[model samples]
Target: MSVVKGLLYPLPLLIGFACAPSALGAFLKDSKLNLNLRNFYINTDYREGHAGTSKAEEWGQGFRLLYESGYTDGKIGVGVDALGLLGVKLDSGKGRHQGSTTLTSDGDHAADQWSRFGATLKLKASKTDLRVGTLMPKLPVLVFTDTRPLPQTYQGGMVTLRELDDITLTAGKITQVTGVASADRTGMAVAGGRRQSNDFRFAGVDYRTRDNFLLQYYQAALEDYYSQQFLGVSHIWKVTEGRSLKSDLRYFRSRGIGANAAGEPGYQIAGYTPDHRGEIDNDTWSLAFTYAVGRHSFMLGYQSVSDDSDFVHLNQGSLSGDLGARGASTYLIAERLQSYFGRAGQDTQIAQYSYDFAAKGIPGLNVTVAHQDSEGIQSFAGSSLRERETDIILTYAVRSGPLRGLGLGLLYGELNSEVTPDQNQLRLMVSYNVELF
Candidate 1:
């Protein structure tokens, strides 16, 4: 593993220099570098129930450096991009440390610091581009999580083509991933499965019309686990000069494939399954509507999960043996700050309101509040359960002067559940970015 990691880390840099030696001037002239600093603090209190710990709190400072080189001038242009990430622990003790959310664990306490580096080699020809090495994809079929101090990263290769007007095509395959809290990379797996699969493939297409309409279809499969297909549509209508309404609809169908279908030992999924057999069979759908007028915006949505299994995604959280691989995100309406609300046979309703203070003379301030109620959940013990969550967020950014580009934010969330422990969480953050030539 160490040998493979070492070779992969410098492969992009080598390839870029070798392929674009003659166009070094253009690459150097168009290069860009940036540095971002972040200070994050989080506290979670378990209001009821008994697991082990009652509360978890942590504070950390993070640094991210990014560099991007311009593509060489030619029919097939070549470029390179690099990333460096570092996280330093500010406050965390044995009792206060949580499971690899913001910081990795060392013995019984949190690690003092952690860091990693990655690079990508890219080539472009006509309206198509190909990238290899580290990737952070944000698509309907697969999206990377960045909720913690450091963002999760994947090792893969992808190609994107925009040859047709108002249309896009994408395909990719990922072999490994490094979690946000850990610096080590591991094979890919789902939430409840202990086995790892190095082959995950996906392809998608997006088409847009002239009349504010978008249509999408995507297919993905994790080897020996499950296969999934997604369909989505979106539209926007202008009610007046300052008012608009938007509607979004999404659907997914998934079923067990190789090992999972055969009921293998380590390939079984977690959550509620029919007949107590851990097979992946699910159909999930959601619809949302948003109305915006002036500085205020309102949104409402509904989601439904099939009773056969929980909604599945590329989740490594259940791989307890892998350090820092305990966090993931899904493209679902129920993906809240504290709880995802993605359980078997669960149905969710969501409401949100946000206000931009610019209309009230505060140009860089904003506030948002959201609520979610979910019920009809089927637990593994053959019982029914329910859960709900409420979240509030406030943010301010300095738009000018010495403190320009500085941002401050606060978030609070509370969750009440019938099957799990009730909890409340608070988060504070400050961030700034610097541009370097």
Candidate 2:
């Protein structure tokens, strides 16, 4: 007891004084916090872009305030993190209303204001930590969806433990979700909101043996919504002293149970599914390979889905790049996000190439191109429906000067479809940020 107390007696003081000795209170001169500002532009209806290059010109401004406090301790360590997020209308409205980004509420310009925030309490002991309240769960089981201007947050408690070599364990329960793009918090549920569930639970284990190998397993459940299981394996091996190749394989399977409680009998996929079924079943797989030589790297990946209906998921259909790869953001005039354009034989494939400019004297500059081919839709034919796309993206950032960290992106695309208008698009974006602590 004497030894234990001696060791922990300095905790509170350290926390109180930036991890000082027991003599210090909870105030430390080195403690810090900061504010950051980000300005963004989004325009989807530019006569010079979409239908011309996939570039839609839209814009907005975001403000974030972050605060963190060290712990004051004894046997327990305590800390807090607070965040304030505010997004104001800068350049979004009808005619140029890109999509469901809340850029426009009812046809006119979006309200000039949108904001939200959350607070968290953290406790630490040895190498383990417990956190409660608002969290941005990043684990694969419940990674907060952040494919927008803002990031989504969840209300939950999570535990991370690491006491064994080559192994780590994690578990958590989430009850609600606050979308990064909206002001309201919605209850957790399976895809479509019909198979609603509130008690989101998950647990996982990861192992690494100091080599180029990794293994992972996780299971997640949404009380009355659905259950999912995941398994992953990856590794990198040296082909030669100066050359290596790496491969990653991932698989996920999901089934429904108590998803739809109030929906019609057949429409109980999860508990109260929207369509039909007492359960939901899906399997997804991805195979990727990379080769590295000198300062250059090459990568290739393929992913596919095998189901008549769109794979079920949370209200936001983010899985499966159905919205178009390269961040088309599920808004390519397709009507909604995750709108899978598939038929009985619908398949998607990706081919990409990249170059590193740093090897050639220039830093922070690169280019990439990808093409997607979709067939087996069994539904479209003739000169009315063509399904194919070729995309080009060029990006550069200023490393110094007033524009340090300033980035510019130019994107272009070519779309060919039988029934829809063949469209070409282009887009340009400029943004910067500053920190005030």
Candidate 3:
């Protein structure tokens, strides 16, 4: 069957079973339904040397409804999940809206409203669960980002096995994805590539030792593009009461395959490449240390990217061209608010400090400050460049009151770069959740 037909054919059957009297007992008893209301606003001001616009600003409200039905009572159970998303443009003055994935575009302006619906059919047996359709994977190889008012979604099937003690296994294949600001599903590709790949496959294993240590390994491939492997290790140590330290290390190796390796037209990545050939061959690594005591936490980290090519991941930004299909996340410590710091041959240093207000009688409140300095970025012309960024964020959530589920957040960030335009950004968000069960 075709991909579209396969994805659509199971919906009616699942819905029919959901409405049947025989499936109502256990299905309804353990089911959950939630509605989330989010108000978001963002503003970016270009400090110097911006070609297109001096500023980009937008405001929108999002409504998300999620429903998860309990599996039928049996050794092998079945269930269904559904998601509904809606976004309404509240403000985006003319000449201020950037065609980003945060909002859909209409002609030369932002769309007034946009919405989409998704469904998934799931099955469970013992310690293994399988889900087909509408995925938001959070694995090290791939992550569905939710930095905007609406979150991105993928069309695929994923299987998770947890039958062994202190071990987890995951495997999945993704065919298409709907961008955060788009209602249409599109194929996946890497940065600066215009061709799309429908076959993105991944598998991973995670093992946790009894002594509070975690080891991870994952392999992923974007068919006809690139293949990648990741290795990670993390551990924590306790020094005294309420004092602890954490150490995390991660590494990735990627290489071009198929069309990308053959240097075919429209299949090459856009970045500083070896000998000006746009092929993927890179190794990236990062190490971070964090210390926590009482209400204070401090972190320091360093990251380096190989000079052959930029770090590779599934990014659809350039594939969709001007349709606003952008925004992606990477499993790197240098992924900041304004920059990823993943440029070819780049090295980045990171530092952060955060405080929890619960120790001072203000529960559910926290603030964080972070900074990054990056240099040795290989430009297309074979010269090096540098950039820096700093971010401040504060958040508060009502702990116990009539408005207990309400949350408010504020963020401010600044970036100065030699390769791109200098800019400052600010974001404000308010969110509340309602239980519909």
Candidate 4:
């Protein structure tokens, strides 16, 4: 079914439960509703006219209504969750509507509006829970992108177990994804693979050591595409009052599977290295360190991708040139605007700083600046490929009054690359959240 149909498929159930509240008194008593209003504007000026375009820009307003219900009172409790999303174009022209980034394309222009809705059925038993249906998952092995007007969601079943102290286990299977600007669901595909896969499976374990250390391990597979494993660890130590140090480490290994390994026609990924092996084979690692004292924080990080291929992740854009159904994200700290620093043989270094004006008695205000430099990207072939990006961000929120939940955020970024397009980007966002009983 299409996203619209799937979203509306459960409306009757919601209406029935709402009408007969007495039949599910527990659910009604624990149910909660929240609505979020968001306005977003984005502009990108291509310094060298990459993608054969001088600039891309779009502005839109979004509304999201989320309803979550508490489980019924029983050893095996049942509940439901619903999400409704609407996006209206405020300003977007054909010249600014780049495929799969800001808005869905309508021929050479952008669609006027788009909407989607979804529901999840959930069951709970003791400390474990089972959820089946539309989901937004944030796992080490897989993450859903939500940087646009609407967040991406998946059709799947997920189970979580928290029976053990200090440890949690999670498992899931995903079949389809609904993009942020889409009214239909699409199968899963990798960055360069043209063929879509309906099966993506993952399992993971998370362990906490004491109160300041965490360890994670996860395995994932995209059928006939690639199999991946990830391991991560993080720790924080308080050196003194209002002072601390932190460290984060992550690693990933990917290898081709089935058809991809067999070199089936139209099954190869894009940007393979050294004679176009055309198979998924990569090993990547990243480490980051941070220190914070008073109102200031600083970070230094490094990441390196294997020489065989670019760091790979699920990217629906490979299937088409439309901006509506294309979204992807990664856990790499080096990931920045328009680039993940993930090209084959790439090595990236990062520096960042942030401050909270609350320390200066100005509450609800913060500022951050960051820079990343990368080299040795294999895409340049015989020539050396290097890139750099600088970004600044500001954010604030209203603390009280009728607009207590209102927030504003601004981001400006400049990127220069030897092997890719150079660009300047800006983003302005405003949001308010309200709860309805």
Which is the leading candidate under lDDT? 3
lDDT of 2: 0.57
Error of 2 at 6 (Å): 41
Off by over 4 Å in 4: 1-12, 15-23, 321-323
- List all candidate RMSDs to the true structure: 3.3, 8.8, 3.9, 3.0
Q: Could you tally the backbone clashes for each prediction?
A: 0, 37, 0, 3
For candidate 3, the 10 contiguous residues with the lowest summed lDDT are 1-10
Better of 3 and 4 by TM-score: 3
Summarize candidate 4's per-residue lDDT along 1-437 as a digit string, tens digits: 25335444676586465344554778667888788888989999998948667999999888788888877777788788999888888999867887756666678888888887888888899999999989999998889998788888899999999999999999999999887777778888877777779999999999998879999999999999899999999999999999999999999999989898888866677874666757888999999999999999999999999988777788787775453568788888898767788888889999999999997887889999999999888763453588899999999998887879899999899999887689999999999988876
Q: Against the hidden reference, what TM-scores do the models get? A: 0.95, 0.75, 0.96, 0.94
- Report the lDDT tens digits of candidate 2 across residue range 212-318: 79898989887765677878888999999868888877666766656343334423432221234444555556567778776577767665544533344455323
Clashes counted in candidate 1 amount to 0
Q: For residues 292-404, could you state the per-residue lDDT of candidate 3 as single tens digits?
A: 99999999999999988999998888875555568899889878888989989889999999999998899999999999999999987556789899999999999998998
Residue range 1-437, candidate 1, lDDT tens digits: 34224423664565456465678877666888777788999999999894868999999988777778778888898888888888889999999986788898787789998888888888999999999989999988798998777889999999999999999999999999989888888887787888889999999999998999999999999998999999999999999999999999999898999999999888878888888788999999999999999989999999999998999888887775646777888888768899887788889999999999998888899999999999989886555688999999999998888888798999999999986789999999999988766
Q: Which lDDT value does model 3 have at 56?
A: 91
